[model samples]
Target: MSAPPLNPKAGLRAALLLLLCAVALVSITAAPAAGAGPGSPDSRRGDRTVVRTEQGLVRGLSHGSYTTFDGIPYAAPPTGPLRWRAPVPATAWQGVRDATRPAERCVQMPAPGASGVTGSEDCLYLDVTVPTAEPAAGKRPVMVWMHGGAFLGGSGSDYNAGRLSVQGDAVVVTVNYRLGIFGYFGHPGLGAAPPFGLADQQAALRWVRANAVRFGGDPRSVTLFGESAGALGICAHLTSPTAAGLFQRAVLQSGSCLTSFPRGALAPGTPAYEPFAPEAEVQMVGTRAARQLGCTEGGNEEVLACLRGRSTDRLATAQLMQSFNRPAFGNGLLPEAPARALASGRFHRLPVMLGTNHDEMRMFVGLSLAAFPIRTEGDYRARLTEAFGAAAPAVEARYRAADHPSPALAWAAVLTDRSFTCTTLAAGRTIAEHAPGLSLHGYEFDDPHAPVLAGLPANPDFPYGAAHGFEMPFLFTPFPTERPLDEAQRTLSDRMVAYWTAFARTGNPNSTDAPPWPALRMSSPHAPSVQSLAPEPGGIHPVDAYATHQCSFWDRLSR
Candidate 1:
């Protein structure tokens, strides 16, 4: 992770990851309506699309190829006394509410380089984008997106759904849920269920089920997808009993049920992180946070009330908010750790698309170079020792810096294999073993020259080749990058959008135009086939992801 903004490079990777995730979330925004008046050449041919939701009637804008309804409340705002609680039904409205603007993002800490805390407590809103070309009869498939910010920050409005909607010909929904302390804080006073942020996402799905047809979407064909933290949330939902029947398909990008980082994986000395925290641990953190904010004068209930009364600004600080980053498991929301659940064959039997980037750890490792420079082979070995302890020798021997351009790249490769690439492949193999009949597809986004989404100072030695979250730009258009996509990259982007949308349309991602994407074959468990997504010709081909990432080596060490 990059350091704070004051340090410029501080938490640069972490900050850039958050920003890239946010931009990827928003890149689905489609272009403006082609023409003006009804009689004009670019007119939508009919009146503005109006959908009568349970709360009220909403008027959305037409973008010629697609229509968008922004800032529609999925549930009542979780503000004031409602803070840290499961979302409640939104109140009905009187008039046709203009759904033109996106609602405020949920309360969140300032991302690195941000001026200050941004977003609001009243942020249980979602945005819907549908194809302008009317469906023949049946409703189009629905895709509900969860934005990523490591459970600390990010909003649904950051993504644009135009390309996904217009090109994929599906209904796309981006959601805003509670974040940071306001979203996942746990206390003894609260019940043993409901990670507020996850609950908020569940509530959004319920809203889509109830109102999808209003916007020409099929509730039964819903697909839940996200990147980084968002993907982790989807992983939780895959195993969440409350999430049953909410989504028919799922896609996990970068993060998964088994996705975790060793201590000092992102930045040297930073604590290791797991997506889920035990309820007791989270409650302990909450108690400490409450006391720090002077809310410990009374009983648990009283303390919660006091904390709820605190201003959003007061609770949403970088230091304070980061404390509440993990969602508590062992509750109604998550009965057990998702990885354990998957191991025991307890996850929902739904079609899944899971994968990671080639150089997943380079982004994080690159950012920490200045503060925790790995200048020599000795520096690299020291980091391995710090992270792996007894396994450091084996890890260092497996990844020699002489094989890489520099020590930093060698360290990044080690982290990538252990933390991301191998873990994701392991997850795929486990899923294949457990859910043999399910349509499971694995992919590796391998555009070595892929545009860097997160702004980092150029390094001569460390080239972030297909780094973490880099594949997002290809799926969603207009992501903030150093330069625009060339013809070949654009072709790759179109192919990705097709594969994604095709998967949403059906469980299978193969289309007539795109190359054949084979499902994960169980026969090759140790070398499971995965599609290599890249820009070059024949780039999108099957490769043994497990063998490529040397997952067998990590599996032995982990055992």
Candidate 2:
């Protein structure tokens, strides 16, 4: 089940593919009158049309003969006094809300390369894509997508569900939830709330449960799928009782429930898990943020009001200082660490599919390359030793410098395995042990032609490989048209859509025409079995991915 890299020549093509991946999360920012009219028909899709939803009637454009809906409010805007509170139901509209124009993205820090889009407090919105002419039939499976941006970045709007809806014939929903401090910060005044970002997501799912049937979806068969932070969110839902029954199946890409980057390991010598932050520590941070805003004790609603009045930029910037580690304890919704809950077999059992990219760390490492240059083997070994200590020597021995063309590539491989591959394997084993009856599928996306974003080195010789978030382009349309998918890659995209949508349709992802996907029985030492996805026609392979990556070491550390 090893996830090896493709030829470096393929990395150039992959760098060009980044634009399409960015398109997956692109959001249209024009706002209309409250309850605006129908949207203009998109010229690309044939036959313009409008559809009625529980919120209101929206007009959307047809692309490839599929209907699209944008800026649908699944929950009320978390503005004014409701900034950090749980999401409330969207107020009923007086007239048809134009679902055509996408709303401003949820208030968050500016993304890399994003321009002119000011963040706002009124950012709780969702977009929907459906493949049906009639909503009443409601036969299409519902797939909810969560974008991955380290829990600090990413938006539901970034992902375009068009291809998944049009080609795979499914109903796709993408949402924007609060991020950073605005979404996750918790304080004592809030009365034991944990990560409000996670709560906002649950609220979105609740909105879907209440109104999905109206939009050509089967609420009973809803499947939750997320990448990175979104995957972590799915893991939250799996454990939170409040999120139970909201989704029947889950697809976690490149992140897992056990994927916690410890803030401070309790005592200096304690094991990583032992240093897990408690509800008090999270509350302490929140209380401090509140105090900084001059919020006094008492007047709960008043304090919330004052905090809400603060500028969105200030809140986003302040939240970033903590460096995106906001999910914490105290909230009744998430009473315990997700990893702890999953380990004890206390989570809500459901069919699950989880995997990571081939070179997951390259997304981060490559971007930092210009700032943090790796000039020699000495530099590489120093970073490795700092991260893994005595174990660093063993890890370096396995992934030797000779194995890669450069020290940068070698370093990227180590981080990718530790942060992504190993953590995901731990999560899979926890699920398999806790819920043996549920269907579990594991995959490693190794497409080297995977997209890389702007600002990174574009040199064809610099190999980014199948880095993190590279799989996005194959699933969504690219923003910049420079690196559109070749025919073979498009076929790979089709297969991914088939696997994801098929999983949403039923517990299993197998179809008569699609490639056969084996259920995950065990990982690593148990067996050599994993699904491999690639752009080449015969590039797909199923082997022992966990064993190839030395996931056993991770499993031991996690234990």
Q: Which stretches of candidate 1 lie over 4 Å from their true place?
A: 1-46, 112-115
Model 1 TM-score relative to the real fold: 0.92
Q: Residue-wise lDDT of candidate 1 within 1-559, one digit each (tens)?
A: 2122222344444544443334332233333334422222221344546778899878777667777789999898788788888899999999779887788877776655667667788889999988778674578999998987777667777777788888888999999888778888888888685789999999999999999887889999999999888998998999888899999999899988888877677665555668788888878777778887889887878998899999888888776676777888999879998898889888899999988999988877776676678889999888888889988898888888888889999999888888887787778778889888899998899999988764665787789899877886786665657777889999999998899888998988998877899898856665547999989989989998788777889989999
lDDT of candidate 2 vs native? Answer: 0.68
Q: Provide the TM-score for each candidate, comma-separated.
A: 0.92, 0.85
Residues 352-463, candidate 2: write the lDDT tens digits.
Answer: 9999888877765665455456668887777666566777787788778778888878877766776678778777888988787889998899888765554355655457
- As a whole number from 0 to 100, the lDDT of residue 526 in candidate 1 is 58
